[model samples]
Target chain A: MIGDKIQEMFLENQENFLIPAREVAHVQAENNLNHALLVLTKIGFNVIVVLDKEARVSGLISIPLIIEAITGVTEIHFDRLDSLTVGEVMRTDFAVLNDDYELEDLLHLLVDNAFICIVDNEKKFQGIVTRREILKSVNHVAHEFEHRYDVQLHQESIFQ
Target chain B: MIGDKIQEMFLENQENFLIPAREVAHVQAENNLNHALLVLTKIGFNVIVVLDKEARVSGLISIPLIIEAITGVTEIHFDRLDSLTVGEVMRTDFAVLNDDYELEDLLHLLVDNAFICIVDNEKKFQGIVTRREILKSVNHVAHEFEHRYDVQLHQESIFQ
Candidate 1:
């Protein structure tokens, strides 16, 4: 994901941020710009994968919603930052790195899932890796598990 | 942010991701890992700042809330991405950039708040730039406007 790194950008470009299902780019939580440019040129858009019903990655849709739906409306409210989408424009209180953690705990999930979240233990999504792919898998496992490891991978202890 | 470009070891050094509201790290919405590691070692924390109810910038709690609170448990229906927060975890669908647009539309807002807003229009914060800070401010304003051309900024909008 921009010259992979950060555990192969969350384990090999984590499905390029999943955009299939007929190239999604919705516009119905309200606000529409020619159907968000017809779902951004038929799904070649920047971001907008939200599904909603409580969650389904529940947030995304930024490409400035086609320049604030053709600019200057004066709506201003629902907590600014340019008329929030893709289901309240996600960032969903960030963080989510469980590909089975390692890579110095995926470099401490590099914060703000602006990239990284390849979960599977039912956390779902099973894809996403950026912060430039766990800082390129912590320089590829720092050659011999960097300084006697600090992670110790969740210290298991569940096997009884 | 990936050693500011995947540890080429600091791409000629000058990295920037400034933060100081006491080094952030302040979780609450009931996930409490010893009070989030004592608020991430008293604010020297790398990330984890999810605030809402008008506290401003929400979402972001790195290391995936200590790996889903040390391997999920609080009632097995789990995977609320580890009990969300900061107003049910951030990324409230964003796209707010009125720092007077047209810097290639703020360098394509580095494709979605580069990992959650950095804000400016009286929202304050001010220090949060990416797309690698708009490619290092387009090479420091093209080497200080190459001997100056009524310097303020602009080079054919860098390409619409």
Candidate 2:
């Protein structure tokens, strides 16, 4: 029953359930370009998600993308970086995962993504999950395994 | 004498000695935008460095930047992504490490970089060192410690 309960918990644990959406950084599509850059640099995040008027996920912005924008990679004037808006440079190519999806499904979605947005069944934006957060989960499991092995070794030594 | 030799070897073990720069993917500034994208996708690199005609490190490009460029983030038509050149979009904000720098110096350089370009004393491009490669080195050392501990424990058990 304990194993079954753990399995059930793992299967039912969704993206929003692991971490609050608000903890992740996001900005409005209409926000100024300088503001977006400030959020990204200040937050120390590689990527920032953009939201639409209805609070739906729209596009993603990254540090490298901003660098590209400033350097005229996207044909923008370097001097005008501060004057532009986030919508002017954010990319639509982003991965979004369902908030209610199981852990197994979440892993599959993260294979090619550094982080992914979580959306509800009706496609309402929830939050995001980064590979760093998933790695923390994996570390916790590994620590538990190591602890159990140590206990087993101690028990065997005492028996001997 | 042996300890001094080990310390000398460790200190002199620079970035280029550990990982060759040619192993990393790079492009020239004059390369076609589409060709750069193809190299990035095919090589499966998160970032690609741009080299100048004299083989000096120039700029850096990333997949997200390419995406930003294609999405008209800088106001270009998505269809024209291939018509452009890499020089138009690459950013000059990158860290470069000296090939002769010590391992300790490499650690400091990597604190703010995912990877750093390596160059010899003449400033000629040598190669690169990624966070992944450094992590691998750490893992190898940890593994050696673990193996040694296991061997010591086995010896102790036999003695008992």
Candidate 3:
């Protein structure tokens, strides 16, 4: 069926889907909120991985978390950024995948997340699988299928 | 064969994928950065819609944009939040889909974006199609296909 074909496609292209850890912007857990904020703004990604001194995945931090940490009852305490650490406010309750994850596994987790952190058996950060990659794979499969079946499944133009 | 079935599934479940505009958080273009930040923090989304007086989508403002706006060469000028308007800092070059967008159109656009804004003929904001919903739809289709084919395509548990 189509599911099997999709699975096959994923298996064939899984290696290219991962954005290597080196390519992803990340911060150490001990880093201050100000530094973390700089990294986030410079990279233009809302969330980034937090790493430990041993190069293991610690957690994830985002702009929202920083905002929440510095917000007070009626005002934002911008001064708090100077005193807080990334580890103090970072979210630890996120999902991660080991090296042996399948395409279905990636698809299942991405239903609720924009990206999935990949880790090794030692809990060290490996890389990330983003929804963009999965969507591209799906698109590629659809196009290939259309060609093979000799049918036009969608309009030629993209959504305006 | 499999691609045809997948296309049919997408067509069948397209209606349930959109998150209505009313349910989405938004701010008027005239709103100050402080108000926009408050809305973003309260809603827990990094980005939100910017609407004009006529309720048409003027642009989008994100936390990163706000950060870029307030940060100077040496320090972050938090006071600028009171002076800046959402319209001045918002990104206006994003892609938008009309009301007539199809499932494939959405999939194609979402390959590069986390979400696509849905607008009307007058360019008024209608709603949003998010990657989360698309992933859910894809998962549902895969499970259905597995059942109909009497095959186990994936392991029982999701990615750990």
lDDT of 2 by residue, B39-98 (tens): 775655658889887778889987556655655333434465667788888888888877
| CAPRI classification of candidate 1 | incorrect
Q: Write the per-residue lDDT of candidate 3 for residues B34-117, one digit (tens) a residue.
A: 999989998899999898778788899999999999998868899999999998999998768998986678788899878899
Tens-digit per-residue lDDT, A38-120, candidate 2: 67655656688888877788899765566555653334344555676788889999888777665555555554576678899
TM-score, candidate 2, is 0.46
RMSD of 3: 7.6
* Worst-scoring 10-residue span by lDDT in model 2 chain A: A144-153
TM-score of chain A of each: 0.27, 0.71, 0.87
Tell me how each candidate scores on DockQ against the true complex: 0.03, 0.05, 0.28
TM-score of each: 0.25, 0.46, 0.89
lDDT for residue B61 in candidate 2, whole number 0-100 = 84
Ranking by TM-score: 3, 2, 1
Best by lDDT: 3
Whose DockQ is higher: candidate 1's or candidate 3's? 3
TM-score of chain A of 2: 0.71
List residue ranges in candidate 3 displaced over 4 A: A149-160, B1-4, B146-160
Model 3 docking grade: acceptable
lDDT for each residue of candidate 1 in A1-160, tens digit (9 for 90 to 100): 1212223323444334333334333444444333433454344434444434433354444434333332343331222333443344333554555556654443434433344445556555444555543333323333312222222112232232
